[model samples]
Target: MNDERDRLEDLNIEEAVGRSTPPDLAERILAAAGKRELDDAVTPISGRHAVPRTHRPTGRRMTSPIARKNWQGAGVVTAFALLFVVGLIAFILLNDPSAPTEQDTAETQEKTDQDRNQPRQRFETPTKKREPSSPDSNEEQPTQPAPTDEPEPESEPDKPEDVVDQPEPRAPVEEPQPEPRDTVKEPEPEPEQPKEEPVKPEPEQPKGAVEQPKDDDKTEVKPEPKKVAVAYIPEDAWRKYEFGRYSVRRSASDEWNSIHGLEKEMGRIWLYEGWQLKTGTGELYFSNGALLQLDGEVEFHTHTRGLRIELIDDDLYVDNVASSSTVFVTHEGLEVEVGNGAAVIESSSGKLGIFCVDGQVSAGGKLIAAGHKASLSNRGLSSINEVTRRDWSHPLLTGARLRQLGIEDFDPAPLGGMISGKIETRTAEQLGLDDDGHVAVDNGGSASVAFRFDGDHETLRGEKVRVRYRVKGAKKLILQMFCPARNDNFGTDIVPGKEGEWNVLEIALSDLRNRETHKDAPPPGTVLSSFALALTGQDDAQIEVDWVELVREAEFEK
Candidate 1:
């Protein structure tokens, strides 16, 4: 418009000064506008780039002088590196805050002494502080929480209540004391048991003094003492007594026959004779003279006497008989064993003491030159001849010793002539005769027979004899004549009888062998004739006799 609008306003004002003039901008705008217009160049160009044509600054605003002197030497080394990083951050916050508070108080006292000694250090540090925390109670596995600031427990919590409140404190020790001496002493001895207790009390005091005398005499005892005896006596007063005491009265009547002491008067006691009555009683007989008896118990019809024979107590009895003959019978020296045929005739005209107690007898005539003499233990010394003419050879016959005293057989020729047991006679001084013819055939010719004989040799010679002569006071009387078959002596005789008195003899002997006027002699075989008796007495003179026998044939038997 105004020029074109003024030429388009000068082409829009020179393209606004060539677009603000840049192309090295005139070397910087003429070096500042040539020193800026030397003085007051602009003060207001500030931000928008302050457009300036050809002032060139914009390659991001311009720098280049070598980059501006390398940015002002990098601003003086960055202001000294920012004052050395502010003094090294204040010297690491002043020595790292007391070295982290002295390593945080020595790691909180080594974690409160590893939480009281490493409670296993939390099971030994797994991954520290890695927390996902929550599982706690199976009783709270304890570990961590220890540090100190004020929670003090470093060792105290060394637990179990600190091993129960801690009180073991002692240490400083010492004591010992005592010892240092040497004294010096020695002596001891003793124990011998008090000298054996006084020698055992002297043997117990004699056993308590011998038991105190057996306990003090217990009751007055004295015992022991005895002896005393005496006896002896004998001075004969009939030699004293005592055996069976005493006795003797006697005299109870065994027929006194008026007797007073003795001397005859005991009659009637015949048999073989025994009689002593006068109170010592005795009477015996039996060979048929009969009168055997004893006390009649009082019926005395008489007959008893003096001391005919007696023995009492050893009892032999008899007395006062014939109270009709059977009053008190028999028993004297009883022994009458007479058997073997009895023909006993013993009678020496008187009995002094007769005992034959047996049998056998045969004697002929002339009362055999007076009496007495019939002795034979066995038999011997006997003679009888009816008529003698003296002649006897060997006629001392006791044949076979009288058949050994039991005489069973006998019969030596009987003619009333030879009666002889045995006979041998001579010794009148060998028969110059005298000396009273020395005949002693048991003192015959008197009070019957006196006997006692035990024979060795026996004899009896017989013949019809008659012999008697006893001159009690001598004139002459001597005879011994024995004849068996032939030695002979036939001297006649003279006689005297009456000294003790008794005699009667008449011996014819067949007229001295005339055999009644010569009957041819020598027919008397072994003949023996006898008649003998001669005694001038005095050999205890006893003569008495009675004779009578003349038998040729006279048989008398009772």
Candidate 2:
């Protein structure tokens, strides 16, 4: 059994050696061994048989142990050569320094195309692991790899021909999805809006010539007529009449007869320039409702429009109850326009007076209200003063009217005795008192003048006396109250301030009693017969007195 096992071992070894050996391997081993044997043969062999040992070839394959050993050695040599070849191939694969392969080229081309189409990408730097260093070191340290000696490749301009042809990578296939039944498309962008400008309004058209439609046919437009202000009179109207010593004239024609004292046939009468008319003791009435009464001479021209009279001289009174435009002009250049009532105009050398009795009158640029008087002069008009009841007295006071006061002899002796002066009564205007025609006492010579008020004794008892006087050269004035029936009297002296100016003096009737000297003086309620203005010891003094009035003390205070 041991011999059989040795044979199987030897056979298995022989098979392995045969598979590992090359076809020319035996010839190479034989050539190397034959040469070594020949060299050994030259060393001169010491044997009787000097020939080398040679074996004859047989037809059958040798299976000797020595042949098996040779086969084993050849197998070992073949295994070693195969291992050396594999190591060389692995080294070449790992350390190859060539350019990119085909797949890498495809990926690079796709990345470049994406970069050109999409927006630019910013490369992020890789973070490197930091090595801790000693804090004591002050030398500058390199934070990154140092620059290499190799020059960078020049970036060539991209020519169309230099671009390589590469197939685009296929995108991954996705699973098929079900199609929706309805599709909604996105709305397109709206067109740009236009800017707007401000709009203006239309202008207004005129009134008469307003714009009309083009289809209108009316053409003629009549303008309204203007108004006219005038009065029409007949040719045969009564235009001229004569009264007392005056010749009636109409526009310079003096053929008209006198219509004086004719009541029914009275009408308008026109007086020419310088033609005087006197309405002597009767009023002259006109058919146009004008009534004129003259105290002295009056020359006037009558306007046909409104029967306006222009007075040339003297004084006249008009009752213009029927006309509103009945105006009168004075010789002193005053225009007195009366309306609806009576008015009186008195004209003298350098003065004019207008009194509105019942209605308004416009005189001297001012309206004289009813019961008022306007005293005007060449210096224009003064302030209008209220008219008293005595202002409407008779226009003229003659000697006969003065004699009716019981002083028939024209003497001052019957009443209070006068001073060494002549007493003259004149119009207030003549005495430089421009009041409306009130009487004034003028003292010519001067020992002091005295005038007595001749009224009932009981009329002024217990009444206050108010006197308005204008004095020129008198320094003082005295008023005396006397009861002639009782033969007792008392007097009060006044030092007049504002010489040559009008002043008012008021005295209570009770205050006139002489309490200091005449203890038997009259009581407060005693009736006084007369009051006198007696100026004593005033030499060369001229005094003009306006008025003296007795009123109740309560009325004077009001």
Candidate 2 residue lDDT tens string, 372-454: 78877877788988877666564531100100001111222323333323445655456454434433354633434344444
TM-score of 1: 0.15
Tens digits of per-residue lDDT, candidate 1, 1-558, equal 455678767765554433221122222333334322212123122222121222332333222223345655776898899999999976887776455565666888887765653322223233323445422211234344577455533331211110111122332222211121112111111111111111000111222222211221212122111111000011111123322111111134222222212121121111101223322222233211122222221111111311122222222222111111111111232111222112112222121111211122222221222112232221333443222222111021111011111010012211223222222243445433343222222342321111111111112111233333223443334333334444553334355545433344543233343222333232222233343444444455443222212111111121
Q: Runs in model 1 with CA error above 4 Å? A: 1-476, 481-529, 533-558
**What TM-score would every model get versus the actual structure?**
0.15, 0.25
Residue pairs clashing, model 2? none
| Model 1 backbone overlap count | 60
Tell me, what's the RMSD of every candidate? 85.4, 62.5
The lDDT leader among the candidates is 2
